[model samples]
Target: MTSALLEQSVVETPSSFRVLTGDRPTGRLHLGHYFGTLHNRIRLQRLGVEVMLIIADYQVLTDRDLAERLPEHVEDLVLDYLAAGFDPGRGTVFAHSAVPALNQLLLPFLSLVSTAELSRNPTVKDEIAHSRQAAVSGLMFTYPAHQAADILFCKANLVPVGQDQLPHLELTRTIARRFNDRYGKVFPEPAPMLSAAPLLLGTDGTKMSKSRGNAISLSATADETARLIKGAKTDVERHITYEPQRRPEVSSLVLLASLCQDRDPHEVAEEIGSGGAAALKRTVTSAVNEFLAPIRARRTELARDRRYLRQVLRVGNARANEIADSTLAEVRRAMRTVY
Candidate 1:
């Protein structure tokens, strides 16, 4: 996607912003990671912006029944991120639980945000649909507030979000405004850096989620990638067209191809002209495999040395603590919680 396209999609603001964004380490990242946020985040760090990546481990409890695999989940996600070129030294990347101060900030933050506001968040509603006991779990109910602390605790001034997450960001901004009003101006109202990447769907054309089995894990073998793409659904018609409304399956393939090859999907469809859905799938699988080759190699190489991966997290957590502690101190003073 061109800068012009992104600019046209979203209004530009002043640069020199501190950024915060992340994911729940429920499992390994997938193709969705590359197109959705990973590539853009790396670019943002290189642009000299201060960046903080949160591994939202605690947030996973909202939907998950057992938290026994938290450590392994975090480890896998960190490795995948490293393989995908997220430099830990250039920016801090740490688990949410690693920084105690972040959770501490939630106490005062909750006082400013209301139950009505939390209930209105779309993410809470969307996630609940996936949970068997969606009606239960206070942790699930209050996730948005915890997310508010995730950004506010680091004093992050900017948050990159998809449109689906705008409601969560709105809650974060609401918390900041309420806190500053009740206490003092201690937190910056975080602004949204809306993503240009569209929501990349899974093989079955549903949202790409681990539970859905439609995701392509970033660490999967080339053969595994080829197998997944080969079986992916396409329209029954032999001819290819880019009309998502009419030919959703074909259009989805084109979108995935465009993301992988960084070329226009419409152009790709044109090049494959009348070759039929089989030809289109072959082209998409090949392009996807070619794109994932280096990432797979990097993942294989990094998986060999587990010690370095642990060290990466250790160092990143310590750096993240420093930032979190500073922000918490200011928050405490603003709320007069200081001894």
Candidate 2:
């Protein structure tokens, strides 16, 4: 039987199915990101869904001390989006810091969610542990509220997320329901459009993350990608196999190749088994480099035309502000705070 979320994707009207998905402008996106969410974003756009991509610049500040390089990070992220086929004409791509209304919506959303509830969020707890912060900031604790504001401000009814993000989406739904019950029905409880894409592991055979320095960046040069994959950690087993439990590192390579070649990882593993890890590495490196060559070239071309890039964001920001303003006006009216 098809899941409710999957059924929603098929039956919902394009005009009614608004999608909101984004990435933090912390660093260049990687292959893991490409397969995980970016690919889904592109598919949603093609399906005529009202897609909104946010550059979560402010969210980056929850853990970091300064955003000195934020501008650069945002620019790079825009280029990656363009190269990955996110057409500005089809969907809006705006920065979180650019929309004032989104921030304003956060105030009321904070009241709906309690401090204890935020503290209990598994995602928040995981991030806190990952950051290893001596003291967690209030902003960090309330990040989920900020995300709810992002979704509700756009009135997005569908949020494309991975399995790891279900808790965050659930919180958004709870806040929406609570607000509507207290004030009035001014928001749709957004549903999770869970991705069916295979999860790509970092070269080190763990979670693909920029902080870990194990990711193959989307903008990496052919040589840089090869170098990263060449030095990737693998097991002592001579033959290649798809035993993720016992040989995660080797299996990660197979998964990468499978994604690149559109073949099964198990088949890829078996095909390269006779040649051992060296052969698997070569296959993975070649597949990844070939896959990224065109994307990198397009990104490099887009980077040179800085004015066009700025205009894309400017247009998207303006439209986003208009939508957000309309939603905020309704919210204020619902709460009887129009004055």
All models: lDDT?
A: 0.83, 0.88
| Whole-model alpha-carbon lDDT for candidate 2 | 0.88
How many clashing pairs in candidate 2?
A: 0
Model 1 lowest lDDT segment of ten: 5-14
Error at 219, model 1, angstroms: 1.1
Name every residue pair that clashes in candidate 2.
none
> 1-339 in candidate 2: lDDT tens per residue?
235756465456666688888999999999989998898888778878878999999999888767658888888889999998899998999999999998999999999988899999988898788764578888889999999998989989888877889999999999999999999898999988777767677877778998899999999888898888888889888989898888888888898999999999999998997798889989999998888888888898999998888888999999999998999899889989877
**Number of colliding residue pairs in each model:** 0, 0
The C-alpha TM-scores of every prediction are 0.94, 0.96
| Residue pairs in collision within model 1 | none
